[model samples]
Target: MTASPEPTDAIAIPDSPLAVLQQVFGYQSFRDGQQEIIEEVVAGRDALVIKPTGGGKSICYQIPALLRPGLTVVVSPLISLMKDQVDTLVANGVAAVYINSALSREEMLRHFAGLRRGEIKLVYVSPERLLQHEFMERLGELELGLFAIDEAHCISQWGHDFRPEYAALGRLKQWFPRIPVMALTATADEATRQDMLSRLSLTDPLIHIASFDRPNIRYTLVEKFKGIDQLLRYVAEQPGQCGIVYCSSRKRVEEVAERLLSRGHRAASYHAGLPLELRQSVQERFIRDDLDIVVATVAFGMGIDKPNVRYVVHYDIPKNIESYYQETGRGGRDGLPAEALLLYDPGDVGRVRRLLENSDNEQQLQVELYKLNVMAAFAESLTCRRQVLLNYFGEYQREPCGNCDICLDPPKRYDGTEDAQKALSCVYRVGQHFGVMYVVEVLRGAATQRIREHGHDKLSTYGIGKDKSQEHWVSVIRQLIHSGLLTQNITRNMVLQLTEAARPVLRGEVRLELAEPRLVRVKQKDKGEAVLSRAEDRALFKELRQLRKQLAEEADVPPYVVFSDATLTELARYRPKTESELLGINGVGMRKLERFGAAFLALLRRQE
Candidate 1:
């Protein structure tokens, strides 16, 4: 949050975007659809891009800024994102500055003067600033190159993290009809994309929807049993690494963070309830590699640009797929291998329901509940996890992605038509007035006082499902709800109700295939067998990591900015002994090579 602008001499106008890519960002080639998206925006046209995290989205608009004549105004949603992006650009020797509430008025005037003089190539501002009348009038006077809206999903009402302020950004397009507007996001579904198109008023735009796949990330989901024990086991398994544990509430965040700290991990808690200065401080420490883990709510990860987060553990299930995807996407941003696991329990659905009950908008409420059911289906699926996730986003990948738990060990599903019929018949017999637990008891023929009082014991559907245990029946109930043969009434304590699709299952018109329940009544091992540690080149890897920390501390930057753990891992394995050998490493650019390459090479020689 410095008040000073990045120093610059004359601008280096690149002949093409490719020149800027190599010289500034240090990439030999554009990733996925970046080349096409950049070509469209650089040629003065509107574009909408949906590239996955770590897919080099920033470069698409950044290269165009280098090639264009005037300052590119980037509308970023987070102050942390603005700061990190500007820091990286300035570190790369590009003149970039950010103006937000974090800056003083004097600093804002100075940066605006720099922009007026065309000294700054990129200017990062927030949605609030863009909506101001004075700012727009002043902006209209300048020759702006383009408008880059990072986290463009915020423009959509259906987006997981929507901002009312972003709805005002559509006026930016109308104010400067000639300046191209590029809306970019890493997370958005079909609804969100359409909303962005309509809100930004992008006409006949070049929409590049890149594949939403992170092949390097391994996905795993386990039922919650002794969850904190399991978390400890996983954390111990991955030694000297960074990860995040996402809880559903601020209280849970504090409890988990405390538990981890008591176990001797450098952990912290983050949520909306924390002081703003404390939250900002924790984020800074995490980014600087000063902490190993941060237990947080969903509010913590939106502005995180750290590349070495090795894993993300969802202590409870997220409300919807969009939120889950964005939170987990925070891992493996360096294009290195990462791990993600969600410890799910049916009890979490009750929490989700309670949260949704408070929302006043009936239309949005229904939409959110439906999305929650879809997310529950993903967590419960016995087939490919990636398949169900991608399908929800309107991308169909027929073949199973072999990177997830289900793909590795698929569950054997049994023909469940008779069982489903029985469940649906019971729901109908019970008058659709009770929730899952009571219904399960009815199926198991529990002679509870409520059942006796309602005369449910005399019903023909009673004791029909006695052969299956209560846990198995509960799992079946969840699956039935997910399969659309049943719906949960949100207003009436989430009572079980039948939708039109339930008729087929009840009438034997459709057959259901359900995964055999594997409910572990007894506690399993304390530590899971989901091993993620890859201590490559042990001896030199240790030295390289220590050196990286030293350099990061000196430069007051993240260790990743000095050289990510992945790059350091490569250095240790290859043991680059010369300048040329160091140059061949994946993340060693000219600036890095000049700064620390010789020192690393000297260490390799000493080791030899």
Candidate 2:
């Protein structure tokens, strides 16, 4: 679906990228690497960009499309994402259209005509549609300046979310050899990056990999016990806020949504099992601010581009780290403070492993199992979550983020050299053939039939340290594995094996420090919502949001398409009272000022 272009004063086309930035987009300057990427693409060269979500990735291509002479074809993965972006671009007065299933035959013909007439600067199409031989022939008729592949990681089989349709995108460079191509994605490991470069045939591409750290989004890991109660408490902490709760199964989604609804929450469940119309309806309602929470499975994945999503909760652990990172990145897209709470259960790890083991492809199962192990390590980590996350992407950061659950309320640490030796000795005594649970039980002197059958009660290491709880021993073993002192062989029944580094610890030659296992959950302090602090400022911000909702409803677009929460926060803080002052805000472009400036200024004046 296309946005209804609003009536506004004519815009004077800017010649340079920076000029387009100021005049068309209403921003005074470019964010970090944006200008460089824009210039590289405009200079007729292929490039690869890896930035965090809400890091202005769209601007890297959109500006070049405007400054360059011909149409820029954007290969998008999802119809809903294309619509959200195209709506935002159109609202900014950019000549952009998306050709997707949402468009009727007549609407598609109109967009085609617009493209042929050189009226649309940018066109977004899915990989499946763009790969069609007939569709490629039709696009060849247009003056093509550039081809941008959004979510480029999808092209790689090694990526978290591989789409076979995206695999055919390498043909874009072959068809339009001279035209520049830019492949962009927010989450891609080094392997994924290399795979994309080879698969997409990006020729000596100028690579710009931004820091993976998202300072605005706080990371939290909560041990899952009485999970539904914990989830309800967390949801209650942020009343009237919009968030997403992700479950691993459809039944769980329905159960959580029902519980929330029974508790008088504006919540709904979305999954692929639901009717297409109902799923669309739920998505529409949530985007329009009529629903505060949508409990969903991954089937409700990446069609969302909602900038105001304040939080994302994973009711169960994800299969891999990339999926976890991308899903959480959906929150705080406005670069405002948001929260990501992961309710991690050890049982969930076993469930995911069992599912992965069911796969016939042994190689793929190994890859998936490795990824899950890393994800579990992240959840069980006592160090900074951001550090672990960034380290996974090969971006090193030594300092603590001070925002995650671990950093906010650090667990106490003590010299556990004896504990380490005992745990290591037990793994060795068990013939290194047991998983974490079996090892923990063996170490804790668990009185079970298996332990009896194994004749482990007669061993010297058996029950050597029965003073500690089962959880404490388990935590010790996990830390040992994380520190490279041990390795869990997923292919071999997930048995624990000592690493070379464990020799010193096992020999009692090296001291080890380990964090105390937190038996109880610490209450994470809530830093109030994005940017509005004072009572008066919050009141004004609320009023601004009400106005935004009304305008967005009338326009039939998401509220963020009108203006981001970050921009509204600035309005509330600075209290811009004139057209000039409102135009000074980051999101208020020439088109927006002409269309919305009057209403915002009037409200500000009234508040004064």
Candidate 3:
């Protein structure tokens, strides 16, 4: 029901998504699995694309929106996500707009008018807004295109961030019988995936699950001791880079932010407890590159679209592996080398588990507890962290990544049969009623009052682990829990209890080969990568960034919309002087070349 066969823009819709990809989005070819997904959607087929955060998931639906006959309706979870997508789309010359609570009524009316007139190619609305009776009636009056559901994982109750409104999205297919619908999510397991498909009523959709590996990110996990010192050291290694340091509580967020600010890091604090306007301002400043880092709780980074974030540091462990993956995915979005470092204490698991325990719903509690166990396993895994994560999502890799801490410097393995026996004996001597920390203290032979009250000093297992550091003892306890020889009794204040699997180890019939406490090694700080390789190119890249900032400020948009850092790097390398040459760059599309090409060419000429 498109109004006419006339193409919307200069780039003719000649039944080729490749042409649209080049002239509009400025890409020569699709990345792995993108071309096939785009072809499915463009051919009026429903699709389910599970691409990683930075793997160009947007293109799979965006190109189809361009090639489709009518306006594509994108149902998004957050208003910020909608705004970010529409901003980039409009910057690239697509007729895209969003209607959300942030928009004025008059602005919303104008968008509605444009949408009804078929002048807008893509319209983004929240699930709540899309379900409004008035909005649905308005939509019914116009010719509809494909339905693109971003963050489709929220439809399932088991997803990391479930939303009730998402559950109502199944009405889309029932209402628009003929139009195709595509669902996209950055993180979801097989259960969530199946739930997403069934909930959306997707009829035999083309399911594309790209590899969940974010190879650009170097994963590092450090045992948290002298946390502030460790943080300071890591920050010192990464001077003048954008990052997010995630804390578990609002108090810690403020403290970390204040300390970073005092140390001249240009940091801001963000949490749900902050004032609405203040939080928005901090997010806007961070996205605009005015702030170098944001020290925040998990509430932050939901819809962050900043592309140049060089690192993501977790000052505390996340609630689950999915949350961890999604949070770390925020960094290195430009596909440049980046870092994901998590400083954690094994005790952090108890704190997170307690949060899960407070829930009254038994089913929900079980699900959350299982997820927490998996997250803890990830933090404590002696195997490759990437392999563990991929395996969690049912993806397999034969070789270790060599990027994570485990793969880089393999942890030393000692026949911990004696050590394991010592730890288990200590837990049992403590009557299996006390928590892991208490058992650890009993093993460490700490002369605390609780130990005195328990009268456990006389036991043979007591002081057995005094030869090892307290951290080493904690690591041993964690490894035993992970190895199935010990289980945390969550129903009973998370006390330590041995499983039947411990009998062989306890009897010395089974040998336990546990890894020793690993020594920390910081990879030589990617110094050559701090800037462009050559000095002149570095200067040009900086100048180009300034130009981009200026153009973005003028247009009232994020700087990434003007040009990403990767594109600027290419521009600096190639020093393209002509429109054709600029178009040859990865992110230089026709509309951008036509708008800002002359200015860049003039600047390059002046530089020469």
The reply for model 3, stretches above 4 Å from the true place, is 1-15, 273-280, 414-608
What are the per-model C-alpha RMSD values against the true structure? Answer: 17.4, 18.2, 19.1
lDDT of 3 at 76: 86
lDDT of 1 by residue, 172-192 (tens): 767888889999998887778
Candidate 3, residues 1-608: lDDT per residue as tens digits?
10111123423444688888888888898899999998888888998999887888889999999888898999987655666677677767788888877776677778788887888888889899999999999999988778999989889867777778999998898989789999999898877888888888898799999999989898998867557778988998898899999999999999888888889898999988877668778887899999999999886887666889999999999988888998899999998988999997877899889887998777667767777876886887776788777766767554678888777866668999999999998888788898777888888889989888879988888888888777778778777765667766544656788877778899999787877664221122333222457899999988998988888898899998887777777788767655545666667776787667777888877776
* Candidate ranking (TM-score, best to worst): 2, 1, 3
Q: Give me the displacement of residue 434 in model 2, in angstroms.
A: 17
Model 1's alpha-carbon lDDT is 0.81
TM-score to native of every candidate shown: 0.69, 0.69, 0.67
Clashing pairs in 2: none
Q: Which stretches of candidate 2 lie over 4 Å from their true place?
A: 1-12, 275-277, 299-305, 358-360, 414-608
Each model's lDDT: 0.81, 0.83, 0.81
Alpha-carbon lDDT of model 3: 0.81
Model 1, TM vs. native: 0.69
Report the Cα lDDT for residue 500, model 2: 78
Give the residue spans of candidate 1 off by over 4 A. 1-5, 8-11, 275-277, 414-608
